[model samples]
Target chain A: MLDSRVLRVFREVFDDEQLAVSDTTSARDVPDWDSLAQVKLVIALEQEFDVRFSTTEIGTWACVGDLKRALRSKLGAA
Target chain B: MSAPAEIRVSLDWGGGEPMIVRWLVADRAPVKRGQAICEIEASKATADIVSPADGILVVVIPDGDVRDQEVVGHIHAVGEALPLSAAAVERGPEPDVEGGTHVPRSLRKAAEIRTLEEGRRGSLPSTVMQQLVVGDLVDRLRDGGASLTALVILAVARALRKHRAFNASASDTGVLLHDAVRIGVALDVEPHGLRVPIVTDADTKTVAEIAGDLQILLYKYMTKTLEPDEIRGATFTLTDLSSFGVAWSVPLLVGRQAAILGLGMIRGADPRDTMLTFSLTFDHRVASGREAALFLSDVRKRISEHMVSNDSGA
Candidate 1:
């Protein structure tokens, strides 16, 4: 299950106010999600979740569901 | 009706991954005479597409469509029938308009200077002229609350009046008082390479009118159509790097021009977290270094006042 807080972070980062976390959402599905915007999103996620993402780990996140899984593991480890 | 020009919105990543359109500006929107049309992620760097003309943006791609390369968008060309595809949209070798080219900086600067000279010859093509006119107007409006090109020119005249040194020129007959002063505005070819196109007798126009003229002038530089009278008569010059993140630059004096002013990028700490740095250079013989510094200080004061007044109005 996706953490509601993490989903909220996504909505705020993309400024969609209407985004939902689902299994198929990738970078392309978001309009304002450019590379620079992605950097900002990552920064926000780290601060909100109190987790550090490795460059390799960040690269592994291709979809919202994928990012959720990574966040879960990081939160569990912490 | 005849066929509208077919503009494709490309999305494929060559390997079949659809690319997303991260639009910076709106569709079918009339873009700033010189601003980027949109930003696209290419293989090497983020590419900012520019508008070739000012017109209603006819949006072909509705923002979220994912496609391959060669996708066309609505063009500025106005006609009953759209232009037939004569060339691939994204296939041209990128003009050295953005990324700093591998060409030596000195060489690049020289080329840009030459290009400016060409623009002064009144040979600047029509397209460039339009862009320069519009861009300059937009810039003035952004800096000042209301942009009547004439009013802006008058303000410049007032600013020059305050600086007596720029008002005088040197010849074999010692120094002479001139009725007018020329001001050159620097245009960035690639948001990096700089070119100066003079606005003839800029001191005479009102600030508002100058704003309108400056927009036309920027278009001339971009389209390569500046007239000789416009580019050749400047007595002083102003270079603005504020749009880019440039902190400052110390420039060499152009021939016969008494002074050159460089406006650095504006930044500051919160309230808003940005800062600004400034540089000014002038002919040591005509205006002492100290005097030049005073002129900058005065201009800074004026700009600060302008900014404050604008904020209040908004």
Candidate 2:
């Protein structure tokens, strides 16, 4: 469920429909996954999942897998 | 007569500079103390600013970004004249110019102040240009859905990153280097005049992504939804006049910024072998002709390499 929702956020942010964000998905893997996209993704995720990421947690994401873990933790805390 | 209450931005925007997004009502409109007079926004939050006291709103700093405790406007009691003369008190925008009513007056003023006064800003302005041959690349990129403007912008961003001297501002002291590669793009809003919206952190984005960003910004401009933040803060400015068939032009620097690039129309007999003319006007206090030449050479090289990168599927 989280991956499905997270992928939707990516799809909307980059305007790409076929982008399959897997566990190994990183900025290197997705060419358009820059700061702007990340900001949009975070806002969408916070809105859909109703969770918040701290300043420290925001920087720890190196890939989609990292993002999942952070989101999972944040969602659980919420 | 009581003193005119000052309108200030006291909201905490988490270190993000809060500014007057827009006035809710026209200047000099009557309002109660709790009435929302204008909208203010920071990176973190957006809120309507209420009047401090019941009075006639004498807008001083009519619009644009404002610092903390900065007086954007003031509210004076009815029937009481402004402490200062009306002419000296309100710095409202000038009358609309011909074919430029849609454009924000501040933006037009900014363009005038930055471009017209470059020669006398104690900055010895100089220009260096290069004619880049990239007909084949342009044809390929155009067929594959790429904007010439976006391509040039990305190339310029990369060049600025590699050559930080062009990304600096010359001050009374020395050339102050900027950490971020925020490219201010001069967009012709047609009858609205010219607007310089920025694409921030441009060096970190790929050409395709930059195109996508440009698309969104373009849509925002068309819809008149561009924010003040997007229009302010430029490490460097880029203006293109190629559509008009102009050959070469020296783009004036924004404020004390180090350099500005003017792109000319693509020219060549063969569509597959076209050449683009671009000139970079630089602050002589910050960089010399040699440095400007090297920077333009890099921009030219990066632009020409578009084919090779696309061929390699980068």
Candidate 3:
């Protein structure tokens, strides 16, 4: 479920409905996943999941799997 | 028909020494008036040499290291033919040794500076770019009678207070982190060279105060009256290339300083939805990639939060 929402955010950030986002997906996996895109992804994720990320938490994400795990933990805690 | 205008590289005694010249437009190519014809590099600074008239480019000097006030080439009107002297054509590339050719003093100074930077900084710098949504902030600043550059300077200065590593510089003995934040603003004094005047104690200065200082600094730079102390001892540096419509640029790191931030043009169709791209080049030895990214994120967050609060208050 977290993956689905993350994927939706990714699609919105990249404006690519056909982007195949997965657990292993990294910046290199998506052509448009640049630094700017990364920031947009973070903002979109925050708005989508209704969770705020601390600066340290924002820096901890390296891949889609990491994002998924962090979102799951935050959601469970909420 | 009027004689073809002679395009020469004007020397900047106060600018970077011995600038390397690179032609942007090809030789003998038709070019427009005011089109960027070449780029000149001096030390870590670069500037574009624009054509003065619409015409064909007749390169008298090929791309190589050039001194100030050297005649690099000429621009001729369409269908006009200029004779190329054998001596001009035979002028070969720059010789390897200093003794082989008369090297300009500025070029030599630039070389010495390059050697020093390479020797002092053992590791290569890491770069990170972030696209920040700033349409609302730009609007609010305009409404509040504030410049975007002043806002960015304040935001970066505030963030640097939290990340001391970036606000510090490398010394001979060790890393020296300064308590005061002095930010340098890079100005493109075109047809001359780039000049960076420092805004001393930026951390303690209000946005209006910084903007006032920036205006005075820029005025000094334009009039060639800036004191040596005004251009030195910056804890951090910021260059805004947005006026040129540049999307992004990776600015060269200044010696001793740990980081430099470049602000690209803010672009968007809607006034309420514009975004600006910022590129940060930091000395990796001082800060890791994550720290830099987080620092940038914090700066962005602070700017956004400040702007949102302003909007609500207004």
Candidate 4:
């Protein structure tokens, strides 16, 4: 599920690589990462994980690990 | 493995307009891994591009009208290729659905008027805060001339004709759009945060009209008597803090709006130089990140290319 979800979000946010996901990754390490990319990533993740994120929460995430932790919390609680 | 050496790729202007290279650190003498390869200046500001995959430096456009956001050079990774060509570092297409409502020209003109009217009615009267050092803004206010904000909006409208993503938004049943892009400039007023004022059918308005209308809006906003119509009907809002030292910000998108652009402080390394920082936040449902990036990059390119120290009130 994470595989599919990550790919979907990647495609939705970046458009070039829908199949781009791995165990070790973060937007910071990506060359195309920018503020616009961050917002797009959050919006895409919210749709993929079927979870909602407050602006404040989205602002705090800097990498994929933090997003994964948030996902676990939101999805696990549900 | 031996690390790659660094290089510095420069676009010599020969006293003409400078061209931007897409590859980062593409011109180091003996480039190393993780070193900056090439640097490109879009206008007043230069982004120090880093080497993506370490490699040998090779230049492509010594001087050409290279497209914005295209990679122009590259380095060789250890046991890898030396230099990647400009065609390789392509940005992917933006995600979006095709075809929907188009904002009519008549509607757009009315919307412009209505925007100014709305701004005048509901909000507390305010003035522009953190006045940007852009000479155009200064001259317009002084001569009661055209506004930079309006010109920017018009440019967006033109871009929408081609890209369409920035101009379109999601509606419950289908897509809602304006044939023209309506842009609202967020005027920071003390005590009340930021207030947006509209500049109508910016695409069609003459530079003189924009400057004169913006002056009127500034007066009304500063006096604290903006009408409700002036603030309403904005499809997009822009908040620029280039007057302050802040470099970048991502503004929140308003309800029913497709996008909002945030601008950071403009500064130069030298006290006398002018530079601007820009950022964009768009409704993902309407335009994906790639779309927003391309649109904003276009805006940056226009400003960097057109703006000069004396290019005020024009």
Per lDDT, the best of the predicted structures is: 2
Ranking by lDDT: 2, 3, 4, 1
Q: TM-score of predicted model 3?
A: 0.51
lDDT of 2 by residue, B1-314 (tens): 88889987765544355666788877777889899988887776788888999989987655555655656689989998865433343345555665644443464464355344643478888998899776555444433434577788888999998889899888878988999888988877555557677998877887766766775665455445677678766889989887568888977777668889999866678775567898999988888899899999999888767756676222
**Candidate 4, B210-238: lDDT as tens digits:** 54556556545654556655765676677
Each model's TM-score? Answer: 0.41, 0.55, 0.51, 0.41
Question: By descending TM-score, how would the candidates be arranged?
Answer: 2, 3, 1, 4
Every model's Cα RMSD, please?
21.2, 10.7, 19.8, 25.6
DockQ, structure candidate 1: 0.02
The lDDT, on a scale of 0 to 1, for candidate 1 is: 0.52
Considering the two chains of model 1, state its CAPRI-style docking category: incorrect
Point to the candidate with the largest TM-score.
2
What is the C-alpha lDDT profile of model 3 across B206-308, one tens digit per residue? 6656666776676566556677678766788898887577889987777678888999966777865677888999888788899999999988887777777
Model 3 lDDT, residue B149, Cα: 82
Q: True contacts preserved, each candidate?
A: 0.00, 0.00, 0.00, 0.00
Candidates ranked by DockQ, best first?
A: 2, 1, 3, 4
- The ten-residue window of minimal lDDT in model 4 chain B covers B122-131
Which CAPRI level is candidate 4?
Answer: incorrect
Candidate 3 residue pairs that clash: B17-B106, B18-B106, B18-B107
Could you give candidate 1's per-residue lDDT for residues B141-187 as a string of tens digits?
43342332233334345677788776555443455556666677766
